[model samples]
Target: MENKFKKITSLWIITVLILFVVAIILGLLMRFNQGGNIKLDPVTFYTDMTIHGLTMIGIWFVAGMAAVNYIMERYVRTSYKANLIAYIMTVVGVLMLWGAGFIGKFHAGWTFLYPLPFKIMWEQWATPLFLYALLVLGVGWTIWTVSLMISLLKKYTLSQVFAWQHFKRDAKPEVETPPFVLISMISLVGVLSCLITAAALDFLLLTEYYSNGGFINDALLMKNLTYFFGHTLANEMLYLGLAVIYELFSEVSGRPKWKTSWYVAYAWNLTLFFVLFAFLHHMYMDFVQPETLQIIGQLASYLASIPSTGVTIFSILVAVYGTKINWNLANLMFFIGTAGWVSGGIGAVIDATISNNFLLHNTLWVPAHFHTYNALGNVLFSLGFFYWFSFQLKDGIIKDKHSMLKILLIVIGGIGFLAAFYFAGADSVARRYANYPEEMASGKFWATFGGTFATIYLLGIILFIGGILKRCFGFVFSRV
Candidate 1:
């Protein structure tokens, strides 16, 4: 079972890295085009944007899910057939998606915001094909999440899985639920909700597309549903990475495992509730959304980040602050990853505020915060897991040499890249523009600079993943 877990995980890691690199290249091209370093047709640029967004989101979400599924098997049995089905479906979905975008020239942003997909400025066939691709991926991922949830329930009851028993003082629950199980369950439930919403929205879009004037979707509702899935998945996937952290952080640092307590239980439970409404923040400018919901969005955004990030950071600090601990690449990645998550999250909160949203609406800052969390935060979390999992399958942190140098590259590069976005955003650089006009010349310089630093960041990822990948491949192919 352990060996099988390893094989499946290694395959996931391999697939994620390959697609991630491709997405990075597409991002670099976008930057270069914007910076006047290179020029791409507007259609080509948007096509790249669509694929880059879709691929990055898809790969990272799967990476988090894969890690949790692999780690969860330690406590409960998992369905290999479900995993295989998801694996196959994901590949097919991605292929169909790529064909639609690249071959058929679907230039709609991965967001595929309503009315725009129907605009049909691109190939007529691209619209329906693109929608179907989403259907394929959504079904596969939804099944995978539900199956994992079922696997957990088979061992532990719903209340136990949620760690509701931990809420009471000195509560001796008949069964102990690991923090990993708690977070994974919370995240899986969120995924299921968001995916269901995604399916509904997709159905609406398809209905309108096929009806040929016989049907229509409410634009506001579609936008609401879109961000609900998009924002929730983005945040929930981060939690998925955090689940890996809760499971591995202390263990990798040679410290004891983190136990589920009242506070931990409270924070995650609050997360599950509040994050569901945090997506409202994205629609704050719609003007048509209820003012009450907008208020709820701001509050939910704050409450969600505060309790969850606060507790996680507090736990990490307590575990490492005065202890003689094992600090390897794995633990270091996790530690630094937490800092990145908090930093990016703070930025997100600032933007969520209504007053601030009025100023920063749809600027480079939008990408700034997300990239900070993703590139530096969630990506690091998964990388940490990959480092730990690969070495556990091979050498147990034997490749500790030049670790500081690698960390240095990642830190310097990430900070540099993000700084560009921050500065450009503050200067009011518009996002998603293929080329900046003479008025936004500074945007060009920043874009070029960001691209350069991102290359450095990519170098660090390459060097770090190099050995991990070798070991993973070896493990994947090794005879049991």
Candidate 2:
């Protein structure tokens, strides 16, 4: 069973890395086109955008899911069959989606926001095919998430799984819930709910596409549902990475294992509930939404991150500060990823505020924060897991003689790339335009700057990929 898990995970890591590198190039191409260094027609540009965004989101979410599924097997029996099913479905679904984008010329900008799919801007058949593709991926992931959650529940009741006994001071429970288990449970439940939301949204989309003017969707409601799935799922996947860090960080650092304490339980519980409503922040620009809901969005955005981030950072610092422990690439990635997550979390909170949203909504500020956390934060977490997992398959550490140089390149590249985005965002650069007009010379300059740094970042990722690939190849052929 362990061997099976390792092999599948190795394949997933390799596949994800390959796709990720391509997506990064697509993004760089888009930036270069915006900078006027490359010329791509509007249709082609948006087409690349659709594929890049969708592929990045899909790969990272699965990377997190794969990591958790692999790690969870230690405590609970996992369903390898379901894992295999998800793998096959994901592959087929991505192929169909790619066909819609590349062959059918469907370019709805990844969001596929309401009524846009019906615009018939691209091939007539592309829209429905895209929706169907999402449905395929949604079904497989929903099943996988629910199966894992059920497996966890079978071992422990809801209260036990959530570590609710820790809610009280000086309480003793017969079963101690690992921090990883609690977070994974919370994140899986979040993922499951959002998948259902995605299903509902897709259903409405398909209905409208086929209704022949008999049905229409409420734009506001669709937008609400869209971000509910998009934002929540994006964040939940990050939590999945955090779950792996919780389980492995202390051990990798040669410290005592992290235990689920009262504060830990409370913080995660707050996250589980608060994260559901936090997506409302994305709707702030829609004047149709009630002020009350907007207020809720701001509060949710703040509440969601404060407790969890505070507790996790505190725990991490406690584990590291004034203590002697081992440091390796995996733990270093987690540590640096935490800094990135917190930094982006701060930027996100600022943007979530209503007053600030008026100034920053739809600006590059949006992508800046998301890219910060995702590119630097969650991506690093999963990469760290890949390094750890691949080595496990190969039975020892595959020493990288250029470990320091690798860290330097990644840090320099990632920071410079993000810095360009931040500068562009603060200069009021709009998001999603293929090119800037003469009046927005700063936009073009920043686009070029961002493209250059992103290329450097890509180089760093390539180096890391080479290292990961060597171990992955060993894993694929190793008997273990």
Candidate 3:
């Protein structure tokens, strides 16, 4: 069973790295086009954007899930079949999605907001193909999530799973929950909720498509549901990586394992609740959206970020401050990744503010913040796991001579690439433009700058992949 699990995880790492490379290439192309270094038709540009955005989100989300599933084995008996099924379905779904975008020319953006998909500027079958692709991915992920939750429940009672005993002041429970379990349970609940939203959103979309104008849908409700699914899932995936960090960061640093305390439990539980309403911030620009929701969105945005970030950062600081800790590629990645997450989160909170949202809406700021967290933040978290997991399969951390070089290149490249976006956004450069107009001539320069740095980032990723990929392949093919 252990060997089988390793094989499945190895496959996931391979798939994720390959897709990540492709997505980065697509992103660089878009940047170059905006810089006037390359010319792509508007349709083609949007098509690439659709696939790139969705693929990055999809791959990274699953990367976190795969890591969590592997680590969860320490505490509970996760279903290998569910993991296998999700892997197969994700591959098929991604292929169908790419077919819709690349072949069918369906480029309505990743959101595929209501009415836009129905416009049908592409192949007649593209819309249904895209929706069905989402259906396939959603169903598979939902099952995997539920299976993990069930595995936890089988060993731990509901209260134990949530670490509710910590809530009672000074009370000691016979079975203390691991910090990993508490965070995982919290993140899984959020994940499950948003996935259900995705299912509902896709169902409405498919229903309207088949109705052929007989059944019109509410545009406002659809937009609400869209962001609810997209925004929430994106955030929850980050928490999943954080879960892995709680489980492995200490061990990697040669420190004691983290345990769930009252504050830890309280913070995660609060995160689960506030994150649900935080998506309301995305609707701030829509006049049709209720003012009450807008206010809740802003408040929830602030509240949601505080609890988890505060506790996690405090914990990390205490663990490393003035201590002679074992520093390796894995723990270093986790440390730096936390910084990136916090930095990007601050940017997100700024944009979520009503006053700031008015100015930042639809500007390059949108991508600037998200890319910070994703490219520099969550990406590092999973990379740490990948590196550690690879070495673990060999029973110890194998010193890599080029580890520092890989880290340096990624840091330099990622910062430079993201800085271009931040600077452009501050200048009020609009996003999603295939080419910059003469008035926004500076946008072209920034795009070129970002593209150059992105190349450096890609080189770093390639180097890291070169090492991990070989080990993963070896493990999968070995007869041990």
Residue-by-residue lDDT tens digits, candidate 2, 281-394? 999989999989999999999999999999999999999999997888888889999999999899899999999989888888888999999999999999888887777765
Give the Cα lDDT of each candidate: 0.92, 0.91, 0.93
TM-score of each: 0.98, 0.98, 0.99
Model 2: residues >4 Å from true position, as ranges? 478-480
The C-alpha local distance difference test score for the whole of candidate 1 amounts to: 0.92
Model 3, range 1-480, lDDT digits (tens) per residue?
489999999999999999999999999999999999999999999999999999999999999999999999998899999999999999999999999999999999989989899998999999999999999999999999999999999999998888899887687889999999998998899999999999999998889888878998999999999999999999999999999999999998999888888899999989989999999999998998889999999999999999999999999999999998888888989999999999999999999999999998988888999999999999999999999999977976657668888998899999999999989988899988999988788999999999999999999999987878999999989997
Per-residue alpha-carbon lDDT of model 1 for 371-431, expressed as tens digits? 9999999999999998888887865655676898889889899999998998898888988
Worst 10 residues of 1 by lDDT: 392-401
Total backbone collisions for each predicted model = 0, 0, 0
Candidate 3 ranges with C-alpha deviation above 4 Å: none
Pairs of colliding residues, candidate 2: none
Off by over 4 Å in 1: 395-397
RMSD list, candidates in order: 1.1, 1.1, 0.9
Backbone clash total, candidate 2: 0
